[model samples]
Target: MENDKKVIALAVRATRRREQLGGLVLVAPAVVFLLLIFVAPIALFAWRSVDNAEAWSALPRTRAVLRAWDGTGGPPEPAAAALVADVNSLDRSVAATLARRLNYSESGMRSMVIALHGLSLSLQKPVLEQLIALNPRWGEHRIWQVIDNESGRLTPYYLLRALDLQLRDGGLTKASDQDGTFRVIFARTFWISGIVTLLCLIVGFPVAYVLATAKGWLGRLLFIAVLLPFWTSVLVRTMSWILLLQQNGILNRFLIDHHLISAPLTLIYNRTGVYIAMVHVLLPFFVLPLYGVMLKVDRAQIWAAASLGARPLAVFRHSYLPQVMPGIVAGLVLVFVTAIGFYITPVLVGGGGDQMVSYFVAFYTNSSVNWGMAAALGTLLLIATFVCLGAFRRVMGTAAVSGR
Candidate 1:
């Protein structure tokens, strides 16, 4: 009998282990899929934010020599010789690449580097004197300082620039007015997103409440109407808004015909157009989550509050709103994050001044071919999104516990 009991216990343990392994196997594909498709790209982009290999790779020997020099004086003789050797060893195309890389750190360095390449053929001994003779700028310690500073394989230059700051004289400082646009752009991005989220909340809450409390076909129809936008492409929906809201478009013409206005309003190609399109697209995001939460709310509690001599407004404030706070927080975070990163609608409908950070990210990635700046901007935006999400969760968690 004892042997049989031990056999049964062993069988139960084996069965549990098999179940656990099966569960893990079922989830393995999803975990691997997220790692490859989502996590890996994000990691690569974050790395690109600080990856500064161009200057170092192009002037490896020069970088080694520069590391030993004191920044207070003129370039040392060995560093100058290393620069000459490095320039001579590079092909013409590679030399041009080095010039471009240096130019990013200091404007006009490209022209100087290219001129040095030409002077390399007729070079004399003591390359330092020849370089100074070839270009007066080479005599300045600041010029070499810029080169030495950028010779690292990794740098905070792009990330600092994204935050409207700079590394100067081995320290952080505020960027100049011209280079300070990034902070303003980031502010604008968040400001617009916040406004859009507010608009969606104002419009979505009542609609979701009606949908949740209504009965029969009316509720179903309204829910379907809210979701109908999802069936259409966002680009198509934005274009449809343009057709309706543009000057001399259907909306303006209708208002003019009805004597509501004497002239067409300037709507498209501005912040107004951006807001209209974004709110229209993101309203459903707000509505769906609110509707789901409202559905789970206890109707009996609300009615009980009303029955106990509470007015309609009081009942709603005390009994209904608390239950729906989580959904409101979730919706706000989703809509704000999505609106912050919007590119297509903003580009198509917004003026240059109204464009968001995502537009600049695309500009750097595509037009400027400045991957470091693009990645740094993207990382900053991601960090902001995560911060907002964390704040929302913390606030909601507190509200949930306190309300109970």
Candidate 2:
């Protein structure tokens, strides 16, 4: 017995060591791949969002002047000359943007005007003194704040721009109406995604219920039909909706021939088109999860309710719906999360006004060269997704406790 015990302990140690080795070997490749592809790029791009200090780094003259200056005092003669020289070297428009960023900290930065005048002036040091004296506002802490803030190479300007806010004259404020703000775009994205998610739940719930209730070969056949869309690419499916929903497309032609309406009606490239495409694409997400949970429900409770003086509708309301509530919550979470991140379907079917937050994020990445703003928007979407998911889970948890 003693010998057998020793052998068993040795075997157990050997097995544990082997398992640990295998686990490390399995995870090492994925860790390396993620570090290279996902982790590295996210860190790099996050750094890019703060890369606004280029102006100060590029202009040594400006740095030299502002180096010794205190934050409370106005710019001295040397600092003023350095700033003028720095402004002259850059393009007027670029200079103006930099000045605006700096102006958030600096109260009386009239040097921006000199910079805007094509860097033409060769002002003496005393000229700056006179300029500040003429505009006594320059001597305040605000002017020094601007210079100090702009001294850094990286700024949070682009991130703020993406949110449609700007730092100006020592404070953050809403962006001008002229340069498109994100307020409307963000609201529309949420509204459209919400509507699409609700439609998916409404349309999919009945289908899932029917599929769940079916038995034998008939149930299997119905399940296959729901799963059929999985064989096609999302882009292909979206394009098919576009073809069918267009004014001259098959759907319109059928409606027109059947005299459903006066004209073919505008369906494609509008809000309605967006909804149709999104619902069609996302229906699968809703049905599959609901079907999974519905399959596990004990049908005895439902039939027992019907047997005990309860009507069919009452049995469903009191017993069947409660059984399927978990599935409904799961399906809603899945469909809403997927819909919120939709870009291709909305872009293909939605008009300029219908474009969502995804559209803006893509635009920033591809056309605007503003990754900071893109990251900011992506972060916002991620936060929104987590919040919704958390709420769904909490509600479901409460429902489960109440049911118990």
Candidate 3:
């Protein structure tokens, strides 16, 4: 009997292992695809936020010597030889990358580095003296201070700049008011996203409720109309709005012809246009999830409350809001997070004052070739999104529990 039991147990174990192996095989492709497309890119973004390999890699000798010496006026005598060796060994392309990094601290630095490379052909005197002669800026304590601050492989410089601060005198300090560009952008991004989310909720919740509760054929037709926007491309929709909202465009022309206004309103290329375009695009995101949740709600309870002499507003506030709270939270998060990272809609419609963090991120990434700043901004935006979503969820959850 004991032998028979052991054989049964062995059979069960074998069967379980085969099932687990099959499940792994089925899941492997999806896991690999997600990691490659989503996880890998996000990891690279976060890594780039702190990665300062170019600084130490370009100035290996300088980094070594500077470790023991205190960061006072300037680096010691060997620092000059170390710098000369570092620059002489680098090709123009490599020197250009290092120059670009240095130029973040001091303008006109790329030209100086390029010129020094040109001077490398005629090294009559020490390269250090040549560097100073090439540009007096190279002899300044501030220039050396920038290099010393950026000697580490991993640095908080990108992150600091993202937050409108900088590392100076071995500690973090407020960057120049002029350099405090990012924080203002961050504030504007969140503020715009908040307004967009609120606008969407004001419009979407009623639309979702009506659609979810409407009668058969008309309901289906309305649903299709709601979903029609999804079929068209976002760019097309945005451009269409521009054509309609521009001065003397369809909307303004109609209003003028009808004598509703004396002149065309300043619509497109302003905050008004940004709000209109974004709300139009993002309304579906807020509505669909909420509509799905609303479909699952027990209409019987709402009617039961009404039958018991509950007012319409009371039925909605007391009976309706609690059940649909999850969907509302989901919709809010989806819209707000999406809105904060908006680029195309805002860029196409918004004025300079209305530009968000994404505009600068794209600028740093594509035009300026400043990946560090771009990565830092993107990562910080991601963190802010998560933090806001978490806080919203918590507050909504608490309200839900207490209301019930």
Candidate 4:
């Protein structure tokens, strides 16, 4: 009997192990998919923010020489010689490429570098003297300092610039007032997203509540209406809003025909238009979650509260609101995150000043071709989204524990 029991125990252990292995096999594809599609791309993008390969690659000899030279007084003779040699070695194409890379660190560097390339061919005197004669700025300590500081496999320059900060005199400091625009733009993006989320909540809550409480056919109709926007492309919806909101479009024309306004209102190409379009696009996100939560709420509990001398408003505030709080939180997070990343709607419908941080990310990536700066901006936006998501998870976890 003891031997039989041992055999049964071993059989149970083997069976459990097989089940665990099967479960892992089932989940392996999903894990691999996320790593490849989502996590890998984001990690690569964040890496680009600190990757400083261009400078080191372009001026390898100069960088090696300057690495030892203290960034003070003036460019040393050896460093100057190395720079001239590096410039002389480069063909026009390579020199131009290096010039463009250096210019990103300091303006006018491209011109200085191109000029140096020309002067390097005919120079015979001391390299520093020739360089100074070519351009007096070469004698300045700051120029050499920038080159030396930027010659690294990794750098904080792009990340610092994203936050409107810079390296100066071996310490990080706020960039000049004229250059301090990125932080302000980030704040504007957050502010606009918050406003759009708030507008969606205000407008969508009633619609969701009606859908949740209405009779069968009416509820279905309202739910379908709420989801109708999802059928069309976002670009189509935004363009439709433009046609309706433009100064001489359908809305203004109707108001004029009805004698309700003196002139066409400035609606399109402004913050008002941006808010309207974003809220319309994001409203379904809010309503669907709220409707789902509200549908499960116990109407009998609300009725019992009303029977116990609670007013309708008190019953809603005390009973209905708590049940739907999770949905509200979920919807708020979804809408805010989505709004922060909005690109086309703001670009097409709003003015330049109203454009969000994503617009600048695209500008750097596509137009300016500054991959480092673009990646830095994208990283910051990703961090902001993750922070919000973490806060939401924390709050929701606390709410769940408290309820239990």
Candidate 5:
């Protein structure tokens, strides 16, 4: 009998080990997928922000002209010769295009273009004359200054601009010049996400509590309804909101018919629209976590508190609130992080003023062709999200430890 029991225990141990191995094998596919899609692209994009030098392609010209050239306008003759050869080789028309592209690499890049164009004219007048027609100012040293600055392999020009900083006179400084700076966009993004998180908590907490206390089949049905949003497309939901919130849409028509307001409310294509859509999309995230924690909560604890002469509100505030705080923190972190990266919902339902950081990220990547700025902005968002998640965990951990 003892031998049979030992054999049974060994079989169980082996089965557990096999299960662990199977789980590890299952995780491998996901790791590979992430490495190929998310990790590789992100790394490449981030690298572009700091990689400025065309060291291999234009090495001779770069070495010649830039050898004696400082950050100021006057580049050496050899550097000019190297640049002319490099530019002229890439395409006689490429000098101007390269100038524009490299300008993102360094400030005051116009001088480098001018310097290069002048050198091209001196070396090969026919090519320079044709190019010079496009921009007569190409003869000045300002263009060369731009070129010389950006000749390095790894550059911070795009990354710095993404953070509202610019390289001016060989140093990084804040860019207060334009209203559409990175700092402005970043701050607005943070504010919008924070507000959305607050809205979700304010609305979802009560709903979750009601769902948690519901009895029998009703509880299961209600919980399923709460989670139904997950099965639908976010874009579909966002578009639905746009249709419903428009001037002549169902919501406005109903309000107008009921004489709630004399005129059609400007609900769609505004910040309010953004808030409504975001809250709706994020509600499930808040509810699910709260409900999960609430399921594990002891109903008898509240009863015991009431029996100890605690009022209903006091029992709720002291016992119920603390018990569900972990869920609240988890839900808030998830929603806020997800909301910060929201693009399609905000774009479809929201106006220009309601664009989030993700919109700017897409703008820089697609429209502006500014990969550095895009990568830098994405990196900042990633860092912020991670920090928020970590803080949430810490807060929940401390609360749990103290609750004991």
Candidate 6:
């Protein structure tokens, strides 16, 4: 009987192990799919922001020597000699590539480097003299510093430039006012996103409440109206706004005919247009999530609070607000995150100053062909989103604990 019991136990263990193995086998394909399609691409793009291989591609020996130097005085003779030898060995194409990389940090290096290749016949001259002879500007400390900064296997060049800073010998330096508009643009992006989120919350809270509590045909009709925008393309919605908001558009015409205004307003191609378009598009995002949460709310608690002699506002604050706060915070975060990444709507409706980080991101990717710059900007934007998400989570946690 004992032997029979042991045999039965062994069989059960085998069956359980087989089931577990089968479950893992079934999930393996999906895991691999997400890894390849989602994780790999994002990791590669983020890596591009720190990629600096092109900096010393044609001058490896010189970069190696520069990397070891203390960087106080002139670049070591070995580095200078290496530069001369490398320039002579490589063709103009390779030389031009390195020159372009260096010029990203400081201007004039392109012409100087391309010119140096033409003048490098002397293998006998002193290292500094040979380089100085080739180009007098090469003798400057700034030039050597630029080369040394770019000598690393990885760099902060793209990331720093995105923040409107430059890596220099003394440490990070603020970019000159003319070239340092990224910080202002970043601030503007946040400012616009905040306004849009606030507007969506104010408009959507009442609408979502109405939908959640409405009866029969009224509820269905309101739901259909809310979902209507999602069915239409974002571009179509934006163009519709353009047709309505442009000078002499429907809005101005209606107002003019009614004698509400004497003249057309400066609406399009400004901050006002951006706000109108963004609020309209984002209102649904705020409403739907809050609506779902509100549907789950027990109306009895609201009635119970009122019956306890609490005023209407007190009932709302103690009963209804606590229950729906999670959804409200979530919707606010979602709207803000979506608004900051907006590209087409802002570009179509807003003025030059109203353009956000996404505008510059597209510029770097498409027009300037600067993938590193684009990647850095995108990475920063992503970090901002994550930070906002963290803040939302914290607020929700505190609210849950305090019941406020």
**lDDT, residue 308, candidate 2:** 91
TM-score of every candidate relative to the true structure: 0.93, 0.77, 0.91, 0.94, 0.82, 0.92
- lDDT tens readout by residue for model 3, 179-266: 6688889999999999999999999999999999899998998899889999999899999999999997999999999999998999
Candidate 4 lDDT score at position 393 = 75
- Models sorted by TM-score, best on top: 4, 1, 6, 3, 5, 2
**Candidate 2 lDDT, 1-404, residue by residue in tens:** 99999999999999999999999999999999999999888677667666765556545786776767654445676666676667667776767666654543343354644433453443444757654655565455555555655676777666676677766565787765435567677778789888988999889999998998899999999998999888988899989998999999999899889999768878989999999989988898889878877888888998788789899889888998888887787777777888889999989988988999999899988997556677778766776887877787687885542222
lDDT of 2 at 271: 98
Candidate 5 global lDDT: 0.76
What lDDT does candidate 5 reach at residue 250?
96
TM-score attained by model 1: 0.93
Best candidate according to TM-score: 4
lDDT of 6 at 50: 93
Deviation from native of the Cα of residue 317 in model 2, angstroms: 3.8
Per-residue lDDT of candidate 6, residues 78-142 (tens digit): 87777777777778888888888888888889888777786635567687876687679878888
Clashes of 6: 0
Write one digit per residue (lDDT tens) for candidate 5, span 1-404: 99999999999999999999999899999999999999998788667667654433444566555757775654344554566667656654556556666655444464555455544354454543444465554455655555556666666666677777766667776764655566777787888889999999999998898898999999889888898889899998998998899999999999989999899999988889999999999999888888888888988999999999999899999998888877888788778889899999889988887888899889988998766678788888888787877776676785542222
The per-residue C-alpha lDDT of model 5 at residue 18 equals 99
Candidate 3 clashes between residue pairs 3 or more apart in a chain or in different chains: none
Error of 5 at 363 (Å): 1.9
lDDT per prediction? 0.87, 0.75, 0.86, 0.88, 0.76, 0.87
Local lDDT at 96 for model 2: 66
Q: Estimate the overall C-alpha local distance difference test score of candidate 2.
A: 0.75
Q: Where is model 2 more than 4 Å wrong at Cα?
A: 1-18, 59-76, 84-150, 177-180, 398-404
Q: Candidate 1 lDDT, tens digit per residue, 249-345?
A: 9999999999999999989999999999999999998899888888999989998998899999998899988888878887887788899999989
